[model samples]
Target: MVLALGGLAVLALWGLDAVRIQPNRIVSGTGHGLIEALGTGPALLVMLPLALVMALAWRPTRGREALMLMLVTAMLAAMPWALSLFIGQFIDDPGGAARAAVSGASWLVGFALILMLIDLRQRLQPGALVTLVLIAVSLGSLGVAFGRGALDSLALVQEYEVRRAAFAEAIVNHLILVGVAVGASLVLALGLALWMRRVAGVRQGVLGVLSFIQTIPSLALFGLLLAPLAWLASRFPLLSDLGIQGIGWAPALLALVGYSLLPMTRNTFIALDGVDPDVIEAARGMGLAPLQVFFQVRLPLALPLLIEGIRITTVQAIGLAAVAALIGAGGLGTFIFQGLGQAAMNLVMLGALPIVLMAMLVDALLKALADAARRGDADDRTG
Candidate 1:
């Protein structure tokens, strides 16, 4: 209740002028607040009812789940009008065309609202939360598609529109880089881990080398790969034909692969090594061959941890691939660097938001998979 009241107070006191308006490149312009979002009279009428509902919902007798649902609904309802008002402020610009863009306050409020929703979801049944999320996403998409929202006018949206083709291409390139690097790393790490397990004497040395590789900064690793890759391309016409080069995807993939090795190798080693000796013995006594024991028993037991390692490496690779743009490897980082060079904050956001969303979604999915694996393991034990 206190937190809800505090949030309300902040919203009322600071208002929700989350967007800044600039008229014809004017040196200064005014900001419109959510308090006056639908004009004074309408805003007052809307806010009073919403506030009353919230207050009523906060009472001890009212269900917390209902309160959370109501609050989220109210916030979503207000979003379109609030955004429209912000965009409307620039519509009648007398001087010339005007541009409206998100401000720092808007970003803060947006993130805070998202966090609040997530917190509320945590309190609800998982099935309920999933339903709510899907509903919200559907409604939000419909709103955007119907042009019922003002997001289209935002500078970030404009940047996306302008470079839509490039954005699509960048998405493809980013996936390719991450896919190839992770695939290669997984294969190599698995082989190395198996070999080291057989030859215990060299395990420490191999891990130490991978650990050293992990310690190197990503940019430095890319730089290190450049010379050898360049030499390989120069000396071998076949390598050049295969798209091997000092810069671009070659070094980017190599660097990403190198960074992935430590986590992948470590996880595989731990998972395989940690398998129960009793389980192994039972499999052998059942007349299972060495390879069969490994494939059917050890591998199945270790699968969850292996998947977890891939999840970690995949998330890491997605983010790092953005940095690969520095060496002419086209990805979302292209927009980020270009935005920085041009001093366009919205452009930077256009590049960044997708990467953030992708990472979050991937992390969530992998976590669910890991949890399922654990549950399955528990069930096996019980049986």
Candidate 2:
């Protein structure tokens, strides 16, 4: 049955192309969407089976069975893209309309594949090979199509040979901004929370200040940094050179880090405060110093809530980082702002889409970390 379907799909593709099929230009009028579709389509396919298989572990279904069904569903969804390409290749006098239709059809196919894989995995069994094939096909296509400029929304690849470098650079910049902002926030927040807990009035006073900072809009915060940072820059030649980058990564990062402090600090303080006095007193009785008692006794018990705060702060910061582009912080936001300036919806979509994916990924990772912390704490308490 699978063989029959595959044969039919191939025949259908050939027939469609014979009729003058065309590709869509959703992201770029100059074949950029086609490149992206070619590059990313396979990745999605491979991921389909993996996601389905993992989901099965959490449900009543067997993993292998769930995977097979998902693969079948994904293959069917991919059919439209194949058929559309065939039609575009063979069609007589194919126009932009053909490309648009193909693009729309491809989106539908992708969406359907995902929905079926997820839905079937939850309700019934699928095969492991199915998922594996989906992943292979998607990833293979991506590799084959990526370097030719089909993986991008911009089609200057033929004219400019520097796109690979540009893409790599963009990826690096985004990683650095997100990494520095989130990492610094975590370290500072934790250290401040620990020290504030030791000080009698410092916790309340500091928390209030952080809360106030949180209320200030991100744009205003970035603007506000210019004066002090600039003044410092003037006082120190090295600092002045750094401030010349101005509204870019530095100011944006500073703003994001500052914004993240409130949630993390608040969560840490609350978690520490909620720790049982009995545990602290016992630790003291055991001859542990105040620092040791707080670290060994209270912190372990309070870690789960503290982690939850970190998760929230990280997600919030990702969204706020988009605004940093206003200050010359180059990120996915560059695409968005550029699109807005040029009145290009496709550019906006390209920029906005990646940011959404990045945010979701960060949120998921942090949530998983928090869950692990909670589970570990539970195990330790029980043991």
Model 1 Cα shift for residue 245 (angstroms): 1.5
Quantify all predictions' global Cα lDDT against the true fold.
0.75, 0.63
Tens digits of per-residue lDDT, candidate 2, 1-383, equal: 22233334333322221121224323343222332334446634533443443444344335544455655554654554454453443334432233322344344435445555556645553365655675567646544554443423221221123244654565567767877987898889888887897787897789889999999998899999867766666678886575554556778888888998999888877888889898788889999998898778888888888878878887787778777878788776776787688765555665676678778877877787888888997888799
Tell me, what's the RMSD of every candidate?
Answer: 3.4, 8.6
**224-339: candidate 1 lDDT, tens digit per residue:** 88899999999998998999899778899888998999999999888888899999999999999999999988998888898899899889999999999988888998889988
Residue 141 lDDT (model 2): 57
- Tell me the lDDT of model 1 at 204: 91
Where is model 2 poorest over a 10-residue stretch in terms of lDDT? Answer: 151-160
How many clashes in each candidate? 0, 32
